[model samples]
Target: MSSKFAQNRSFKKNCTAFAAFFIMSVSYCQTSTYGQFWNEVQFNRTINAKWSTELNLGSSYSSTETSSNIFENNIQKSFRGWGHYYLSPRWKISSFVAYYDNKDVPEIGQFKSPEWRFALQAIYYFHKTGYTLSTRMRMELRHMRNGDDDYENVLRYRQQFKYLQPINSKILRKGVVYGIASDELYFKSGTKVTGLSFFDRNRLVVGAGYLFTDDIQLEFAYANEYLPRDNENQIVNAASLTLTFNNLLPNLNKKLLHKNEANTNED
Candidate 1:
């Protein structure tokens, strides 16, 4: 009886999240800045408890302002890869690079330079609710060209606060369902000396996650973004999907835990 009740509750929560996302998408789609739609998938694998890596593949399209039609733009392909390391239980760091190749759409015209970026990041963990809470900080160097001109160099900082809350504790023995949300702010690293403005971009995301096991999880969400190049009044909405796999090194986590326990015992 209790198990069935919990399942019912989980279903309600999932439906609520989806409904809210749908409403937000519809409400925002009416504006000129809102026609950009995106779908993406990501994979993450752990080399061990201490090291992990990621790959993300995605595509995006935007409607022409004049036509205001749905899904009218050509697809933009993206590739991203990163590696993360656990320094300790509470701290970790990552470095990543990404590339984007956007095809010519009548509305946006051709962009000469494919955009690419390299960044280093650090995350601090403070809480665990089955779904964890953490903050991430990153510094990025972006390389891009709009035309025949030289590549513009921009240094950016991004800070994000994230929450992951589990829905069904009983079911967590085999799998778990959770809610996740995060907000990120971007800032230019320098202003007077670098001649770059302080503000750059911002992003907000909300979604739910399901963990099939400690080894695998998937997340689906909606993202709203404010880009510096786009009109200030416009907000771009994107759909996001991510998958995570852990323990690629098999017994490495167990070995590490055992080793740590042994060290503590000796002390």
Candidate 2:
């Protein structure tokens, strides 16, 4: 009983510290704020015991002060492909290539060209009794055209800490609901970056996810992004929704076969 009490106390203390950090990071910048809505769909496949892949398609819409609807204006569309190799159950390394098609927004004008980005990342997971904690580090190389129509090469690094807790069960599984919280910081340096501060942005996300089946999961999250520019800092409040399908091709084939069998029996 005493050991259990000590463990509970430690958990509470950690939670309190995390809350304080998240609040401070979000409040660090008070500037022009806008609203956005983001939607994403991901398809995941596992090839072998140690290898997996993912493809993602996403889009975002922005809202201005004068806009009647939050998702009134389309701002960006993106596609990404990722390959992952698991070193162990608790560690994974991944690389991805992404393309972004950005449109002109009232707050930030159109870019001279769209962006192509490549990133390498590693994630380490710590399994606890009823929850999991993860840390991810990513390095990104971005290629884009600057405002002056000059090609720019940017290097950026990101660090993220994420926590996951199951709400009604000890482990996350089919029909399970889980809560997630993550904080990420970005730092950048590039030829086009003339800002004195290398600190690019911070993103804080809090959300919940539901696993409908072994192959499908859906998540909804609220993200707070703080970006500091040379002149004016900006904050974005975004509502994000993501849907993931695992083992997409195999699952689709199985469903199709099942349907056909049912139709034949009916006939």
Top-lDDT candidate index? 2
**Candidate-wise lDDT, in order:** 0.72, 0.87
Residues 195-242, candidate 2, lDDT per residue (tens digit)? 446898899999999999878999999999988875568788899999
- For model 1, how does the per-residue alpha-carbon lDDT over 5-88 read when each residue is reduced to its tens digit? 999999999999999999977665543355556666666776777998888788777666565553776557889999999999
RMSD per prediction, one decimal? Answer: 17.7, 14.1
Task: Give stretches of model 1 more than 4 Å off.
Answer: 1-32, 67-70, 103-112, 129-131, 170-174, 189-197, 228-232, 247-267
Instruction: Show where candidate 2 strays beyond 4 Å.
Output: 1-30, 65-68, 105-108, 191-196, 259-267
Residue 57's lDDT in candidate 2: 100
Clash totals, every prediction: 0, 0
For candidate 2, the per-residue lDDT at 216 reads 95
lDDT computed for candidate 2 = 0.87
Clashing residue pairs for model 1:
none
